[model samples]
Target: MTPDTATPSLPPTPPSRRAEFRFDGDAREYFRIWIVNLFLSVVTLGIYSAWAKVRKKRYFAGNTWVAGANFDYHGNPVSILKGRAIAVATFIVYSVVDNFFPKVGYALLLALVFAAPWLVVRTLQFNAANTSHRNVRFHFHGRYPEALAAIAPLIVWPLIGIAVGWNMSSLPASGTEFFILSMPFIAFAAVYPRVVGALKLFHVRHAAFGEARFALDLPMGDFYRIYIAAAVGAFGLLIVGMVPIALMASLSPLPGLMVAWQAVYLGVAAVFLAYTRSHVANLVFNQARMQGGVRFVSTLTTSRLAKIYFGNLLAIAVSFGLLVPWAVIRTARYRASCLALESDGEMDGVLAGVSENVGAAGDEMGELFDVDVSL
Candidate 1:
C-alpha cells in the first residue's frame, strides 16, 4: 500500500476539567447582615421579611462560585412583599373560616391539596428565573399538569386512606377492617420512592441554565435502595442509641431521663437524616448531566453531614440560636465543597437563554404552607 493510503491516527481527546463549587460566605459577615435583617423584620412586624429574604439570597448567591463565576439573585422585593401579603391574607381567611365553619374549612383544605401542585410549579419557576450564573439565567419550565402527575400518587393515596378510615369507623370493626382501612396508606408508603423519583426527574429535566437544558436519568431503584438502607440503619442506630437512655431512665431522675431521651432522639434523627440527605444528594447530582458536555459530581459523606447537623443542633441549643449564622455558613460551605461541575473544555461556549418575569406569590405561599418542592 502507498504511504498516502495508510490510515491516519485519531486526535487525542481533551482532558476533562472539574470545577468544584465554592462558598466564600463569612460567618461574621453574614451574622451582621442577619442581625440587621432580624431587627428590621421585627420592627416592621414581619413586613420587611420580603426584603430580608432577597438580601439573604443575594448574599448567598454572590458568595457561591464555580468555574471562576459567581451566582446572582435577581429577586424583586416588591414582588416578594406582594406574595407575602397574599399568603398572609390567605392564612387569615383560612383561620377565620376554620374557626367559624368546620365543614367549609375541610373544603378549603381539599382545595389547597389540589392546588399544591400548581403552587409548587410556580415556586420552582420563580426561584429559577431569579437565579443567574455568568450572566446566564436559570429557568424552570415545569407545568401544573406535569407537577400534579409527578406527585399524584403521593397525594391521592393519602386522601384515599383518610376517606376509607373515616367511613370505616362507623361500621363494626373486624380483623380485616383495619387492613382494609390501612391499605391505601401502605400503598402510599410503598410508592413513596417512585413518587420521589418521578418528582426529581420532573424537576431536573425541566430546568435549564441559560439555553442549555439539564438532564437526569436516575433510576427508581436508586431511591428505593437509599431509603430502605437508611431506614434499616436508622432502626439499628435507634436501638443502640436508646440503650443509654433506657439505662438512664432506670437509674436517673425525671429531668435526667428527659435529657437522655432527648439526646438519643436527636442523635438518631441526625444520623438518619444526614445519611438520607447525603446519599440522595450524591446520587442525584452525580447522575445529573447538562447540555454542552457538562456533568456534575457530588461527594457528600454521611459522617461529615451528620457531624455538622448534630453539632449545629447542639450549638443552637447552647447559644440560644446565636450560632445560627455560623451553622448556615458551615453547612453551605460543606455542601458547596462536595459538588463540582465537570466539562470537556467547553465551559466558555455555553450561551445565555431568555427568561421571563415570574411572580413570587407561589414561593411565599409555599413557605407559609410548609410545602418544600424545591430541587
Candidate 2:
C-alpha cells in the first residue's frame, strides 16, 4: 500500500437531468382496485376507508422510487385518524346548526364561506404535517399567507359563477343559455387547481427542509393546457358519441337505444377522467421540485407507472372486493414507483438530510402539541 500510494478513485456520479413523471399501471387494473376499495369503504360506512387510504398511500409511497431511493409513507395513522375526526366534527356541527337554526345557520354559513380561505390553509397544513420524507418530518406553517392569497380568487370566482348563472337564466332558452350558465363552474374548475398549486408551493416553502427547500415551478400555461385538453377531449368525445345515438333514435326504438348510448357514454367518460387525472398529476409533479440549495435526483411519472396501478386495481376487483386491504398496498406501491428526483451529481439520497419533526405522533388524547421549526 505504501509502494502504491495513489488514492483510490470514487465511483462516477450519475448525470443530472430534468425530472419526468408517469403512472405505473394500466386502466382496467386501476379501476378494479378503485372499485374494490370503493365497495369496502362504502360497506364500512367510511371507517374502514380511513385505514384503507393509509394502507394505499403507504403502498404507493413504498413502491415509488427515485434515483434508486424509495419514498416511505411514515405518516402516522393516529394523526390521520385525528384529522379525520376533526373534519367529521366540523361537518356535523355545520350540519346540525344549518338544519336546526336557519337564521343562525345562514349567518354561520356565510362566515364559513368567508373562512374558506382559512379552511383551505388548514387543510394544507394538516396534509403537510402528515406527509414526511425519510425520518424527517414536515409541517405547513404558511397557512395564513396561503389563505390571504386564495381569499380574493376563491370568493370572486364563485360570485362570478352565480352572476353568470343569473345572466344565462335571463337568456332565451337554447344550448347557448346552457353553455352560459355552466361557464362559471367551468371557470372555477380551470382556475382552482392552479391556485391550489400556487398555495401549495407557498406552503411548502414555509416548512423548512434543512438545506433543501420546496418550490413550485407551476407553468400556469401547461397547467391550463391539461384542463383545456381534458375538457375539449371529453366534450368532443361526448358530441361524437351522441351522433350515433341520434342516428339510432331515427332507425330504432329510441328508449332502449338511448339507455345503451348513455351507458357507453359514462364508460368513456370515466376513462377520459382517469387519463386526465394522470396527465395533470404528471405535469404538477414535474413542475414542483426543490429549488435554491435543494436538488431533485429523479422522478416517477403517473403515465409510465400506470401499469402497476392498473394491476393493483385489478387485484382488488378480482377478490370479490375482499382485496380492498391490498388496494392501499398497491396504490402505495404504484405511487412509490412514480417518484423521481432532482439533485447535484452525488450518490447521497434524494431526501438524505431533510428534517422529520412530524409534530406529535400519538393519538389525539388531549396532549398539548407544539411544532418546533428551529431544530
Candidate with top TM-score is 1
TM-score, cand. 1 vs. native: 0.92
- Model 1 stretches astray by more than 4 angstroms: 1-6, 157-191, 251-254
Residue 103 error for model 2, in Å?
Answer: 4.9
lDDT per residue (tens digit) for residues 1-375 in model 1? 556876789999999999989999999999999999999999999989999999999999999999999999999999999999998999899888878975577567668778888888888999999999999999999999999898887787757755674567477768878788778878877888777788889889999988989999987999999889988998898898788778777786577677777887888889888998888888888888999999999999999999999999999899999999999999999999999999987787888988899999999998998776654
lDDT of 2 at 41: 82
User: What's the residue-level lDDT of 79 in candidate 1?
Assistant: 99
Model 2 misplaced stretches (Cα beyond 4 Å): 1-14, 17-56, 67-69, 75-79, 100-103, 139-141, 157-187, 203-210, 254-259, 271-275, 291-339, 347-375
- Model 2 RMSD in angstroms: 8.5
lDDT of 2: 0.55
TM-score of 2: 0.63
